[model samples]
Target: MNSRQGALLRALLNAGDYKTAGEYGRELGCSDRTVRSDVKALNAALAREGFHSHVDRQRGAGLRIVVVPDEENRLVRLLGEAEAEMHPRYERLCQEMLALTCHPGPHTADLLARRMFRNKQQIQADLHWWQGVLELSGLSLSLGRYLKVEGPEWTIRGFVMSMLFSFPAPAVRRRILPSLVGSLDPYDRQFLERCIAEMQRDLGFEFSSNAQWQFGVYLCIMVTRIRLGHSLAAWRDAREPGPFFAYLQKRLERHFSMTVSDAEMGLLRDMANCCTWQWSLAAMEAYEPTERARALADAIASALADAFGAPVPDDMRKPLAILLESGLARRGCGLVAPNPNEEAVKYEAMDGACLLSSVLAEVPALVEADLFSPDYARLLLVLFDYLEQVGALRCYRVGLVVNCGIDLALWGAHRIEKLSSRLQVTDVLTENEVAAAAARPGSALAERFDFLVSFEPLDVKFPSVTISPAVSRADIDHIIASVPLWRRGREVRTAWEQEVLPVGPSPEGLFAALHGRLVDEGLVDMPRERFEWLLWTLSIVKDRTLVLAWCGPGVRRTGIRIFRLEEGDGAECGRCTMAAVLVVAPADRGDLTPLTQGFKRLVEDYADTSGAVNDDGFFVCFPDPE
Candidate 1:
């Protein structure tokens, strides 16, 4: 079947029920007639593969896949990533872009386009898109196809690696690195491995399993390219190498049968830095605010509970706090480490991540951390894991596979997970394993997933959806619209959406009101230095403050977040931050009964909660204006 047919099949299989041709067409980035033709082709392919399943047409509801239990895996193998082969025009262009960046040379645009399975015009359009994205790198597409990625050498290498490999799942990443490293000529691989081990031993620390695996991947990629006569330029002289790297290189060259090139040594030196980089107590303190950061973490856990109107277990606080501190340090200090789970985390726990990052970034201290990075996604995953451990996140099992190119596989899986918060996905297959499972009958993978999602139809008897690798925005919309119909979905979807609602009002107004109230009530505690500093930080933006304030005219009471930073011997509140809600509407002001009731619960909740709360906790200095 053509790529379009495979995509059509995926969309159909993924659907909870039949969708009309127009709906399918809109999702696959194609026309109704094309979708119909592709569906016809897909059914024929299914039959030819001896699968007792076909795309069945419904007059009004749309098309659905009719599946026989035993034939699922075979169908998926027939359509997965191996078959896609840069089939979509856009994918070919993407590959072309990578090829241009990694191995750029003189060639006409027409020649490159033909090589990429595209017409010249389509290639040019893609180049324009690439231009916009690549402008950050000062890279541009030369019209004649002589692609130039002009930037610092290290940046270009990293960008090429990102585009070249399909680093999708953590399992796949761990599995792939060894295979790639092992495939290298025994002497080179062995020597490199021994050097890494020796470095760890001599450095008085071991690299995390993840760091080692990624270093291996980096080495394998760089070595493979070097063997193919592509190596980075000698970016720095030998005299400038890190001390540990210099030592590690000398030991390696002493054992190797061949002389290592300066370029190769440069790469080796980089690997050394990556493996040894640590975020120690001192390093973290360089960013400051560990205690305050811990308080922010407590407030977030508390805020999430209050915002969602659910109680969080006390057990999640410490782990969440640790995750936040590490994330802030890593992002703030520019500690770029390899995190294979970044995609998976972004997919699985996006809302929790959004909420946490949204809360953390409000503090003036953390502005440097672009909490929106994939790093934050990885960090958020840790928080979600903690929540799940404490029975707060509410997760479910999902089985997912991507049969298309690596780009779509990662992108689609991320999209699927982001579109639903309940799903805890397991995607372990590499290109070969997926191909093997697709060709074999009754694979073990079928038993693990409650439902399988694949771009290719699988051969197993498990429930599976075959979607196009090129899942469009329309497809995502349709899938999101269908979430409530999934099993145990109604409550899950509702909670997921509200996990990170936007706070309103401008920064100046939010802080001014809070500051004015604290001063007016003689509750503005702490020295002028500390209070003003806090004000300067918190007042920078209402969006950045971690306060949980709910305001509406119909509310019978207010639930405003108040945090007392620390305690002092005297009666003065020491370093506090609180947002007050003023009631302007007359109808809801009949009694302070609701106020008392709400405050009781909030006080009860925040009592056990560790935040900036003082010993005289949850005190309301402002009396009711009414």
Candidate 2:
């Protein structure tokens, strides 16, 4: 079934009750007669396949899908396979290319086009795009009399494994894996899942559900790629392949009859290396990082300090080294790779992308090199937890000014006071006399506190968060998470007030520019909500080397996105360039309006402890509404 059929089938299956003909038609965006016709075709297809389900219809009730009692799994798999094959253009092309990679062989252009259900021109266009897709995995796609994927043997294997690792888990909300390399050996898949559970227990590091899927698919693919003769050969048993590679090669050599290359063997060992990493800090460091990787780690630490004014503690250097080394294998071999936790880290962990992206900005040349990935963000989070645990991450001093309009509001202020020790409450002033509080502003009280909390909104020159006196446990927990990040909005307001000439790009232009940057920099594609994209776009704010804000259509119309560029070593007030690109990472385009409040909140969080700017200032910006 194609997308239409898949959409229709999914709608029907997801419904708990019968649907009307008009309802089904509306849901599928078709005429009732058309849906009925499609239903007939669907029923025919199901009957032809000997499936135990058919669309049953009642005059008023639209349609109901009845599944056989024990045929649920079978029907689901059938529908999944059918849905995977229905593609429109690029996706279909990608699918065909993947199929070619899986079993590269002789086929004339006419024959290939016929097999792909496309014309010759479409096939050629697909081939063109396929070339670009291959480059991401360090492979080259070439079509001759026979289809062949040409690349260094190691890279070819890497390309395949990376693709395999990217396969969507069966349990994904949408199972979008194309036909090629989509199916898994049931027994092998089970074994790998069990292995992930065992590894998590052994290592004492929890794996998110997604992480387990990543590792399982990666390990399973390694085995499948080997048995299929897509492996490496050992030129020498000694250090040529490295000891880890040699050891893994011996383990797998008996399992596979084909020759395994040193690269392939090395890739397999990296699977363990990644596991060691996810397992525990000490276990990960046991596999020493290469000097180059260690040096890169040092440079990373130094650059973060240089760029963000935050120093990476020296004690955490070893873990950074291990992470860098594992990153090398993941990137180099393109085998089992970790799903980046950038989403959790970006807004959650204090814009974690800053550390890595800053490193890229320092050495612009490394933008396309090994430095940028969601994986980099994950590494930073691990570092952040350790630093916080050791009390290296700085905390802000806060004060509370409670003036209760009601008893509940007063209680909330007390709750804020009773928060964890991370926040050292400098003072708490209970303003029982409203006339006195109104007569005398809390500006001085607000100034004394790094963070200001109040039951009643105070007319203080610093930002004061007015909370209900009766806060819930969850609200308190949220406050705890945010306490360390509490910045007086005044600081961000000041940083933003003194602004540079802003760049505005139309949504289209913004995406195009970002997409261009990704390709030019040889960087992997980012998620749709890419914070790195935001950082890259905002390059106008700081010294990431943009001549001027690439002002497009929106910045003038959209709310301003601001960031602080703290003075670093060799960094002084003499410099003229001042800006940060405020675009989202990786994916090119989306409306920036939704991010306005979030942008203000994050900037405030970043500048929470900056003692500049008046405490009563608002931390928001408004665009010139057209």
Candidate 3:
């Protein structure tokens, strides 16, 4: 069960059928004598388990576990022995060697190299070693060369089990158990139990594996989060007395025969309450109104007390009252009124609204317009309803531009703005600069106007219009000039329109306009040759706008065509055209094919159909016109 023996067995397993002692020695980075000794030790261990190891001298020479005993049991016994006998540091080293390489950013490789004082070659070797180990366990490790680590089922299970044993104390185990088991599914649990059972039966060692402890911690965190809002008060007042927590506790005790102490339960309740209050307050401050926040706080507190095993903290009750008063004082609910003129305030509000809308929109069953309310509690209820509709909320921490004036803008935005500013000074303007200047009139020195506007209608909607090719800069300037007011006007008009009209529901009518002007003798017939070429060229033009007028958001039209032109010599000249049209919609659309796959499939289908065209002397292959 030593490292050397395990290494030999791994080599044999990897080699499949069999391997010579010399081959095994070379792979293990050891001498032939060492390999022989390792084989002998492994065979002895196998013999003890009522399995025989045989080396066929005449059959091309390689040791094999002739009586392939239950592999699951063998692995378990090996793991138990390794755990019992291996030095802590040696065990750590083994784990490290078996660790999957995480896709670290460009800087990560260098950072890890520097920290470990190991070269890139060594790191790569370790990655290979881990991959080999995982292969033995019917698992795979995928590390994005520059991003993240994704371990397969068995590998992940093994890592979790290792982590469980690695903890020195029960408190540490309790703290980490949730993180360890939270990501596992039923299959993972079964695999883990198999590994544990194998170890117990073969090695005569009991694994201190507690499914209840693992599940309890997971349920506790979620239950606490549910009863508490993502605010300061929610975090503070989060207690374990919510019905969900109580139910979870009962389930755990019934299933595992383990009892949770009153003291531990109290502490857990307090922690949940505190977390709940804190998050609730933060969420309220960010999005909800005073009255709504107060109501939400009450609802969450009551929910927590009724379901979980603990009551809301007394301090949280006082703060909730104070928050309500403060909210009312600031606005009607002690919340400050939104300031559109202030860059920070305007951007924050817009960003928050966009985020909230996106989160709610993901839930197909929830009506986003109906969810907006002045009351905090009602808003929270709506948010929860949306989350429930969506089945789950994946919480991710992302950096927000608290002060964009100070923060470096994203590359595309910065580049566009920089080019526009340079174009204002230069005589020769770039295409990008011209586009930017058209979007925002005047030089960058001029006061920037807020483009966002809110309207009081049955449903919240943003005014949007597609730019027509015919619209001139002067025409746009005249429209801007006509509208004296910059804020929400009584009329719905673009920066280019003349007379503003009251904003109405989104228009469903489609308007078609020609881009080019007609001559005095209008509508002249185009030459057949020119028209034919133009139509032929259209096959190559993958622009979605030209192909389909009403493509859904984020959807693009792409296809392939094969054109066969027969010459007088009875020979055919063919051209294969693969076209891809990229369409980015003005708003988010739920269903859209990825651009790459869409193009690839279009080309593949076109090629397949084109190859089977009729033997008519002249042939043109195209997709179904409709």
Output the number of the lDDT-best candidate.
2
Off by over 4 Å in 2: 1-95, 107-126, 136-138, 143-146, 171-256, 274-277, 280-318, 334-340, 351-369, 386-397, 403-424, 431-438, 441-443, 456-462, 470-491, 494-626
Q: Quick one: ranking by lDDT, best first?
A: 2, 1, 3
RMSD of 2: 14.1
TM-score of 1: 0.43
TM-score of candidate 3 against the unseen true structure: 0.23
Clash counts per candidate, in order, are 20, 43, 55
Query: Model 2 over residues 427-499: C-alpha lDDT tens digits?
Result: 6666543225435745344345555665566664454555555565545544444343234333321112323
| Deviation in Å, model 3, residue 391 alpha carbon | 28
Please, what are the lDDT tens digits per residue for candidate 1 over residues 214-304? Answer: 5665666565555445555665434455576667656655754334466566556544444333344433333333474578666666655
Candidate number with the higher TM-score (1 or 2)? 2
TM-score of each: 0.43, 0.54, 0.23
Candidate numbers sorted by TM-score from highest down: 2, 1, 3
Compare candidates 1 and 3 on TM-score and give the better one. Answer: 1
The TM-score obtained by model 2 is: 0.54
- Per-residue alpha-carbon lDDT of candidate 3 for residues 63-90, written as tens digits (9 for 90 to 100): 5544355574564445344532323322
